[model samples]
Target chain A: MGVVVPLEDDRGRGQNAVAQLQALVAKEMQAVNEFIRERMASDVPMVPELASHLINSGGKRLRPMLTIAASRLCGYNGTDHIKLAATVEFLHTATLLHDDVVDESDMRRGAKTARMLWGNQASVLVGDFLLGRAFKLMVETKSLRALEIIADAASVIAEGEVMQLAAAKDTGTTEDAYLRVIQAKTAALFAAATEIGAVISEKNGSEAAALESYGRNLGIAFQLVDDALDYGGRAASLGKNVGDDFREGKITLPVVLAFRRGNAEERAFWERTLQQGDRQEGDLEHAVDLMNKHAALEDTILRARHYGAIANDALAIFPDSPYRQALTDLVDFCINRNH
Target chain B: MGVVVPLEDDRGRGQNAVAQLQALVAKEMQAVNEFIRERMASDVPMVPELASHLINSGGKRLRPMLTIAASRLCGYNGTDHIKLAATVEFLHTATLLHDDVVDESDMRRGAKTARMLWGNQASVLVGDFLLGRAFKLMVETKSLRALEIIADAASVIAEGEVMQLAAAKDTGTTEDAYLRVIQAKTAALFAAATEIGAVISEKNGSEAAALESYGRNLGIAFQLVDDALDYGGRAASLGKNVGDDFREGKITLPVVLAFRRGNAEERAFWERTLQQGDRQEGDLEHAVDLMNKHAALEDTILRARHYGAIANDALAIFPDSPYRQALTDLVDFCINRNH
Candidate 1:
C-alpha cells in the first residue's frame, strides 16, 4: 500500500492521482470494507480473530480496489460490486495466509503473520475457511462467467506457486521461466479481478479485454517492483525485509539476472549461498553488491516500467474519467514506488 | 479407506455391501479415476507427484462413491455424475492434505503424508491447487445449485475445523459442541455430496431431502466410529496411530463422555494426560481403561449405531433397487467397521 504519491502530476498539476482514484471510489470502498468485515465473522472465535489480525493489518487493499474501480469504470450500478470487491480481497488474503505458512515467514505487511501468531495449524485451516468464504461470496454474485474467470485464475496461481517452489534455489532457471512464474502467480488474479468487474457489469466487448490487459500488466509491474524492493528497499518503508528473497534463497528476476551475468567465481558464490544454503555474515551484502554491479535491480525496475507503460496504454480507450486516470496513475505509482 | 468391509452380508449368503457397492459403481468409478488423474496433471512436476502421493495412496473414495450411488439411485443417466464424483474426491483429498499438515501428521492411511514427504509448503500449495480444480469441476457442471451446495458445505467444514482446533485439549467440551464439530467437519461434505447428486438429477422432491438425511446420518456415524477406533483400533488395521487424538489432547465424543462421567481422581488423571499434556508411559492404556470402565467406547459405538439406523431409514423412501440396498449395507459397513 504505501505507494509513491507525487504531490504534483507529471504535468505539474495540483493533486496526486492515487488520491483521485480513492476519491472516485471512496464510498464504494467503504461498502466493500463493511462487506469484508461481515464475511470475516464466524461462530468460532479463532476464525474471526485470526482473520481480523491479518485482514485488518495494513494491506493496501489494492486488488479489491481494482475490482471496485474496474466495475465503476464499466458503469456498473449494483450492490454486487461490493461483494465482488470483498471476494477479491478475501481470495488475496487467503493466499497470503497460505503463502506465509509456505514460506515460514514470521511477518507480512509489517505485522506478525497468522502463522507466527496463531501457529501453522490455525494458519492453514483459517486460510481454507477464508477461501471457502470467498467461493460462497463469488457464488452469491450469480455471475458464472465471473466465477469461471476467478476460479481459473486461482488454479493458475496455484500452478505458478508450484513452479516457483520447484525453481526456488536453482540459478539455472531462465528469465522466461521466472517471467512465467510471476505472470501466473501475481498477474492472473489481477487480470481476473478486473475482468470479473467488467463481466459483472455485463460488458464483454473490448472493454472487458482492455481491463484484463490493464490488470495483467499492472500486476506484472507490481511484482517486478516488489522483487526489486525486496533487494534494494528499506524494511520499514517496504513493510517487509530487504533481501527477504535472498535470505530464503528465492529465485526472482533480480536473482536470475545476477546469476546469468556473474563470472565463474561469482557463480560459485551464488550456488554456495543459494543452492547449498551456506550463507556467511556478509553474503547478503555481497549479493547486493553483485546485483548492483550487474545492474540487476535497476534492470528489473526497468522491466517493471515497461509493463507499467503497457498497463497505462491499455486503459486509453476509456474516456478521460477520473477512474480511468487514477488507474493509469496507479500503474505509474506501482512502478515508481520505492516500497 | 481400508474400511471394515464385512466378508458377508447379515444373511450370510452374499458378498460384503462395500463389494456390492463397488460392483454397482465400478464402471463409473473407473471413469472418475481417469478424470482425477487428468486434472491432477500440471506442468510442474511436484504438483502431480504430491497430488498422487496422497490422492492415489489407497483412499476408498467414499464421498465420491456416495455421489455416484446417490445419482444412480435417482435414476439419472447423465455424465455429470462423473464430474460430481471427482469433485467430491478432489475436495476430500484437498482437505486430507491440509489436515495432515495441520495435525503435523507424518502418515495418513498407512502411507507417508505429503507434508512428510514433500514438506508442508508443497502440501499446502498443492492442496490449494486441488481445491481450485474441484471448484472448476463444480462450475463446469453448470449446476449453480450444485455449486452452491458444495461450496457451502466446504465453508461449514472449515468452520468445523476451526471449532475443533479451538476445542482441542479442552476436556470440558460439551457433547453438543462435539456433535457440532463432527457435523461440520465430516457430515457437511457427505450431505453435500449426496444432496448434489439429487440436485444435478433435478430430483428436488422428497428424494433430495431423503438423500440429505441419509448422508448426514451416515457421516456422523462414520466419524463417531473413527473416533472410537482411534483409541481402540490397531495401527496396522486402522492405518493411523492409536493414540493420535490422545497425544494431541483432542476432544472427541469419547473424551467428552469419559471426562464427564469420571470420578474426581479419574478426572484429574484425564486432565493431566489430555489437558496438561503430561502423558505418562501407560497413559494410552490408562485412558482406554478409564473409557472402558465408563463404557465410553461402547456408548460411542451405540451412538454411531443410532445414526446408522437413521441413515438406513432415510433411504427407505426410494424403491428397493440394488443401489439402495448397497447404500443401506454400506451404512452398516461404516458403523461396524473395525478400522
Candidate 2:
C-alpha cells in the first residue's frame, strides 16, 4: 500500500481515478510489489537500499498499474503477467537512477535521490543490475514477442535520453523535436507495458495494437501535464520544487513555444538563461510570467487534452468493464492532476 | 582491420597465439565488426562518435573472439553466432564506458576515453544505449537458455562492480574476496560468451560447462596478469599509465599480497597510500619496491599460471583442431603477456 502519487489533496476525482485503478488490481499489484522487493535484494546492501529509497518513496506506480490493468482487461489469467509487471517497474526504476545521475538532480519524490545518498557509482551499477534483473524476468516469461517489445522499448528509452541530453539547454529546440523526445523517453515504455499485456493474453492482433496506442497516448499526455506542472506555480506543493525545469535550464514545451513566440528581447532572455546557463534569482518567476502572457502553459495542457482524448478512444474497442473504466479514468487523472 | 591488442614489439609466441586465435575467426569477426558498426549508428551524432571512439580504439576483442572461436569449436555452422558475437562486444564496450566513468579514467587503449572526450553524462547514456542495443541483439537469437545465460552474466557483472566499489580501498580485503570480485566483474562475461557459443551449437551439455570453465579461468588469469602488469614497471609502454591502479588507490592482488606479507612499517605504508589515499611522489615506486621485495608480483603471476593451467585442461575433452590449439595458446598468451 504505497501512497499513490502523494498529491497534497487526496479528495477529488483525480485521486479517485488512481485509487480505483489500483484497487481493481490490488492482488496482482501485491505480487508485483513482492516480486520487486525480493528481486531487489542482493548481498550488496546498497543495491537494496538505493532501490528501496526510490521505489518505496511515493511513486504513482502508474506504469505497473497500467501493466496489470491492461493485462486483466485483455483477460490474462496466468502468473507470467506478474513477472512482466514487476519487470516494467524495474525498468522504470533503473532509468530513474541513471536519469538522476545524468541530470545531477538532488531531490526526487520529495526524498533525496539514490545518487545523492549512495554516490553516483552505486547508482549507475545498481541501475545496471536492476536492468539485467528486468531482462532476466522478461526472459523467464518465455514469451519472445513480449520480450522483444520490452527490449525495443528499452532501446528507445535510451535513445530518447541521449537525444534529450543532446538538446539540453538548447533553446532553439522545436516543438516537434520535443514531442519526439517525450515519445521516446516516456511513452515507449508505457506503450510496451500495455502492449505486453495484450501479448501475454494471446490477444496479439488488434487488442495489442489498441492497448499500445492507449499507453502511448496516455504517456504523451502524462508527460505534457508533468512539463506544464513545472510552471503551474504548484511545484512546491508537489514533491519536486516548482520551476525545476527553469533552474536546470530544461527547455520544455512551454519554453519552446515561448521562445519561438517571444520578441527579440524575450528571445535574448531565453538564449541567455537557457543556452548560456546564466540563471539568476527571479528568472523563474519572469519565465513563468512570460509563459502566462503567451498562454503557453494553457496550450500545453490543451495538447495533453488532445492526446488524452485519443487515449480514451483507444479503450473504446473493449467492452465496458471495471478494468476498462479504471484505465479510462487513469487518462483523466493524468491530464487533470495538479501535481 | 582493427589491431588486436597492439602490444609493443609484436613478435614471438604470445603475438602468434592471439593472431592464431583471431585468424581462425577472422571472417566471423569481420561480420561481427560490421554488425557493431551498423547497429551503433544513430541519428544522434554523439552516439556513433562515442561508440566509435571506444570500439575502434584497438581493443583485444577477446570476448567476442571467444564467442566465435568456441562456437566454431563446437562445430556450429550457423550465423546466429555473428549477432551473438557482436552482442558480446557491445556488452564489453558498454561496461568499459561505464567503468571509465566510474574510475574517472582519462586514458584507454592509448587513446582518450569516451568519458574524457565527451562528458561523463554522454558516456553514461551512451553506455546505456549500447547495453539496450546488446539486449535487442541477444533476443533476436530466440534461444531462451542463451538469453538467460547472458542476462545472468550481465547481472553478476554489475554485482561484481558494486562489490569492487565496496572493496576499492580496503586493504583488509582478503584474497578470497578479491577473487570473487574479479570473478563477477571480469570473468562472468568471458564465461557467458564461451558458454553461449557451445549453447548456440546445441552443445549445452558437458561442452557448455567445459567452455564456461575455460573462459572463467582464462578471464581470471587474464586479470591477474593485468593487475601485475600495472605494477610490473611496463606501465609506460602500455596505453594506460603504469601505477594507475596505485594512483587511484586501487588495491589489486599485488597490493593485497604485499600488504598481507608486510612488516609493521610497510603495513603502515600500505594503509597510508591505499587506505587513506594519501600518496606522496615516491608512493608508487615505493609500493612497487615493496611488492618486489615480498615477491608479490611474481606470486601473482604464479597464481595466474595456476588458473591458466586449468583453462588449458578444460579443453581436453574437445578433439584436436586448429580452434582448440588456438584457444589453448590463448591461455598461455594471457598468463605470459607483459602488456
Candidate 3:
C-alpha cells in the first residue's frame, strides 16, 4: 500500500495555510483594532494620541494571532477569543512602550519610538493605561484561568526585563542567563497567549500543557531567529538596521555563542567591542565576521530549528487539522525566515 | 440634656479613636512590609535589589494608612485589609519608581532614587514588576469590585501623569487641566485606598459612595497642601526641598493661580521662570515672593481647607465611633500637614 501524503500539489498545503492564516489574522486584527480604539479613547485627547501612535504603528500583532489561532484550534467558537486576543495585544503594546522608555530607544520599526515622539512621561503613563485596559478586558471575559495566565505572564515579562537590564553589556552574562531573560520577556507572553485559549475553552490538563509547551518552544525559536537576523539580515528586509543590538551593547545569543567558541585573539576582539562599549568604523562588520568564523550564528540557527521542531511535535496531541498544519508552518517560518 | 464631652484620660470616643487608628495603621504597616519584601524578592537577584531599594526607602506610607483606616471604619475584620493596604503601597511605590525614571530625578525623600542607584532600566522594569505584583495581590483578594476600583484608579493615575507631561511648561495649561491631572494622578489612588475597604467590607451603596467622596476630597486637600509647600515651605518642615517643583518646571496649583492673578510685570516674572523653563539664581525666591504677593498660596490653602471639611462631612453617615474621629483628624492632617 502506498502512503498517502497530505501535500501533492506545489500550491496545495503552503498556499492554503497562508490563506487561512491571513484570513484568521485579518479578522482578529480588526477586532483588536476596534477594541484598542474604543478602550484608548478617553475624555482627554492625549490619551488617544499616545495610545494610537503605538498601537497603529505597524506592530505585526503576532501575540494576538497566537491567541486567536490557539482558541480556534481548541475548537472554541465564541467571541471571547476576540477579547482575549485584544488583551494579548494590549499587554504586548504596553511592554513595548515601557521598554522603549527604559531603554531610551529613539527608533522602532524605522520610526521614532512613542517615548521619543511623545515623551518618556507619556510613554510610561500610556503603558500603564494599556496594562489596566488589558485587565479590564480580562475581567469582562469572566475566566479566572485567563486572568491567572495573564497575571503570571505579566510578572514573568517584568522579571525578564529586569534580567535583561542587569545583563546588558555585561561580559559575565551566561547562556543560561540569556535563556532565562528570553523566557521571561518574550516566551512567557507567547505561552500565555496559547495556554489561555485552552484554559478558557476547557481543554483537559494534558492538552493545555501541550499547547503551552508548544508556545514556549515556538517563542524561544522566534526570539532566537530574531537575534540572528540582527547580525546578518539586511536592514531593509528586517525593517531595522543591522548591528542595532550590538550598538545597544545587548549580548544576545549570537554574541554569547561567539564568545563561548572564540579563540584567544577572537576573545580579545569580543572584549574590545562588547566590554569597552566602543565600536569604531567597521566594528559591526568585524563582529559579524568573527561570529561567522566561530560558526556561532549557524549553531544558534540550528538550536532555533531544534526548538521549532519540538514546538511542532508538541501539537501531535491535536488531531490532524488545517489549523495544526498552519501552526507547524508558523514554527518553520519562525526558524527559516531571513528577517 | 448636657452634651457629655468625654475627658481626654477617659479613653472615650476621642481617645479610643486615636488608639484604634494607630493600632490599625501599625498592623497594616507590618503586613505591608512583609508583602513588599516577599513580592520584591525574585529568582532574579537584581529585581529584588532594585525593588527593595525603592520599597525600603523612607516613604510616608500615607496611602496604605488610608486604606487600613478606611477599612477599619467600614467595619472590616478580615485580613483582606492587610492585602489591600499592601496593594495601595505597592501601587504608590510603583508610580514613584516610574516617576523617578521619567523625571530623571536623582533624589527622592532625601536619598538616591531607585533609578539613580540602579539605572533607569532597572527602575522602569522593577516598577513594572511592582505594578504587576499589586494586581496579583488584588486578584488574590477575590473581590471583582476591588479589582475594578483599583484598576480604574491605576489607569487614571497614568492618565494624570500623561496630562502633567503634556502641560508641563506649557502656558496654555489651565486650572481645570491641573485639577483633572491631580484628580487622575493623586486623588484617584486616594479614593481607591479609602473606598476599597468599604468595597471589601460589603458596605451599602451609600456608605461606599461616602467613603469614595471622603477619599477624593482628602486627596485633593493633601495635594493642595503639597503644592503650597513646594512654593515656600521650609525643607525642615516639608521633608522635601522647597522650589523643587519650580526647578522641575512643574506648573502646580499655586503657580497656576499666581499666573492667573498676576499683573503684566508679575506675569513676565512667571513666564521667565515657568513658561520659558529658565531659572536664574534667586528665581525660586522670586517665584515664592510673587506667589505670596498674588495671594496664590493663601488661596490654595483655603481651597485645601474647604476640601478637608468636605472629607469630614463624608463621615456623618457612619456610626459615631472613635475610629470615625481619627478619620476626621486625618483630614485635618492632610490639609494642615507641612511634610
Candidate 4:
C-alpha cells in the first residue's frame, strides 16, 4: 500500500479520513493504478518515464478516489468503474502535465516537475499520449454517457487554461472571472470524475446532479483554499514555495479581492507588481500585507468554507455510511489541510 | 468555395487530382467543413482564431476527402461519414498544431504557423482542444470500433513523434528508423481515416483492409516525396526555405541513403553538419551536392513510386468510379509533385 502521510497534528482526522477512503475503494483504486501503469508503458521510454514520474510522485490519487467513492456511494457493483476511474486520473494527469508547461512551474507535489526534468516537448507529447489512452479506455468501457462527460470536461479544461492565460497578471480580473477559471481549470474534471461515477453506476438524474454539485463545490473549495494558502506563508507546506502565484503574476482569489478593495495607492501597487510584473524584493511581503489589510486571505478561506458547506449539504440526499462520511470528511480536509 | 491553389508552372495533374477528389465528394466535404467550423468555435476566442488561422490557411483537406471518398467507394449512404471526415481532419489538424510546435517551424502552407502568431502554449492547448472535440465527434458516431481505431492511431502518432525526436539529428539513423517515423507520424492517420470510412459503410474485412493498405501506402508515398522535395531545390516551392530539414538536422530517408553511400570524408561531413548541427556557409548547397552525387533524392522518389504502385494495386479490388479514378490519380500526384 502507498504511504499516507497526514499532517503533523489535527487529531488525525485527515489521516483517518484518507485511510477510510482508501479502505473503502482500495481494490478499485488498485485496479486504476495498475491500469495507469500498464497503459503508460510505451516503446518510447520518455513517454512512460515522464508519465510515471508525475503520477507516482506522491499525489493522493484523490480525483480517482472521488470517482470510486461516488460510484460506490451510488451503489455501483460493476467492473467499469475501474476503467472510468483510470480514465479520470488519466485526464487529470494529462492536464497537470500541460499546466506545468503553461504555468512554467518548477515543482509539483514537493518534487521537481516533469518539465523540469524532461523539458516542455516531452511533457506536451506525453500528456497527449495519456489523453489518447484515456479516450481508448473510455472506448473500452463502451459507455457513451461516460465518454461524453469526460470529453466535455477535457474541452472545458483547455478553454479554461486559455482563459486563465489570458487573464493572468491582470489585476482587473473580477471574482466572477476567477471563479470561472477555477471552475474550468480544477472543478470541471472533479465534477466529471464524480458524475461519471454516478453515470456508470446507472444512477438517476437527481443522484448524478447531486454528485456533480458535490464535486463542483468541493473543487471550488479546494482551489480557494489553495489560493489562500499561496500567500498565507504556508506555501512550503503545500509542496510549493509561497508567493509563486505572486511571482507568476497569477491573480487568484486573494489578489482579486485585495485589488478590488484596496485604495488607489494599493491599486497602483497591484498594477506595478502584478499587471506589469515589475516585482521587486519584499513585494511578496507587501502584497501579503495588503491582503491582510483587506482580510483577503481570511475572506478567501471563508469563501472556501461556504463552498465546502454546500458540498457537504449536497451529499445529504444519500444514505449515511462510512463511504459517505469519508467523503464528507474529505471536504473538511480540503478546507483545513496545511500540506 | 475555399481556394485550391496548385503550385504555379506545374503540369496540372496534382490540381486535377485534387479537383476530381473535391468533385467526387463536394456535398459531403462541405458538410465536413461546416462541422469543423462549428465544432472549433469556443467562448475563448483564441481557440477559434488560431484554429481557423491554420484550418482555413489553404490546406487541401486531403485527409477528410479521403474519408469521404473511402466511404463513398464502399457505397456508404449514411451521414456518419461526415462526422468521421471531420474527426479525421481534426485529428490531422491537431497533429499539425503540435508538429509545428515540436518542429519549431515558423511557416506552413505558405503562411506563418499558428505558433508564429500565437505562442507554443496556445498551439499545444488548442491542439488539445481539437483532440477533445475530435473524440467528442467520434463518440457521437456511436461506433466503438471507429473510436478504437482512431484512438489507437492517436497514441501511435504521439509515439511516432517521440521516436522522431529521439532519432532527430542522428546521422547514424537507419532507413528503417526513418520509415518507422513517417509511418507513425503520417500513415497511421491515413490508414485510420480510410479504414473508418470502410468500417462505417459496413464494408467487409477485405475491403476495409484494402482501403487501409491503400491509405497507408499513399501516405508513405506522400511523405517520401516531401522528404525528397526538401533537398531537391524545391523547398521554397513547398513554402519553406531550402535546407530547412537539413538545418533542423532531421534524419530523413535522403540523409540516411546519402550517409550510407558517402565516402569516409563525406561521412565526416555528415557527422559535422547533421549530428553536430555545426553547419557553415554553403553547407546546404554542399549537402545537396552530396545528395545528388549519391542519387539519394532520386532514390527517395523511386521509393515513393514503389509505394505508389502498391497503393494503386491495393485499390484495384474496388470497382470503377470517378472516386476510384481520382484516388488512383492521387497516388501519381503524391509521387510526382514538387510541392
Tens digits of lDDT, candidate 1, A106-171: 778777788888998998888888888888898998888888887788778888988998888898
Candidate 2 has a DockQ of 0.72
- Which portion of correct inter-chain contacts appears in model 2? 0.61
* Model 4 Cα shift for residue A97 (angstroms): 1.2
Docking class of 2: medium
Q: What is the full ranking by TM-score, best candidate first?
A: 2, 4, 1, 3
List TM-score (chain A only) for every prediction: 0.94, 0.94, 0.91, 0.93
lDDT of 1 at B95: 92
TM-score per prediction, in order, is 0.94, 0.95, 0.92, 0.94
Give the lDDT of residue B233 in candidate 2.
31
How far residue A149's Cα lies from its native spot in candidate 3, in Å, is 1.9
Off by over 4 Å in 1: A1-15, A233-240, B1-15, B233-241
- Ordered list by lDDT, greatest first: 2, 4, 1, 3
Error of 2 at A261 (Å): 2.1
For residues B260-312, write the lDDT of model 1, one tens digit per residue: 99999998998898888899898888888888788887789789889989998
* CAPRI class of candidate 4: medium
Candidate closer to the true structure by lDDT (higher is better), 2 or 4: 2
**Model 1 clashing residue pairs (backbone):** none
Give the distance in Å from residue B142's predicted Cα in candidate 2 to where it truly belongs.
Answer: 0.4
Local distance difference test, per candidate? 0.86, 0.87, 0.79, 0.86
For residues A1-339, write the lDDT of model 2, one tens digit per residue.
121232444236665899899889999899999999999988878778888898899898889888888899998889999999999999999999999999899988778899989999989999899889999999999998988898788878888988998898789999999999999999999999999999999999999999999999999999998888887622322233677788888889989988998999999999999999998888877887888778887788789989989998988999999999899888878877866
lDDT of 3 by residue, A2-75 (tens): 21112323334434554567576687668777887788777767878888888888876778888888888899
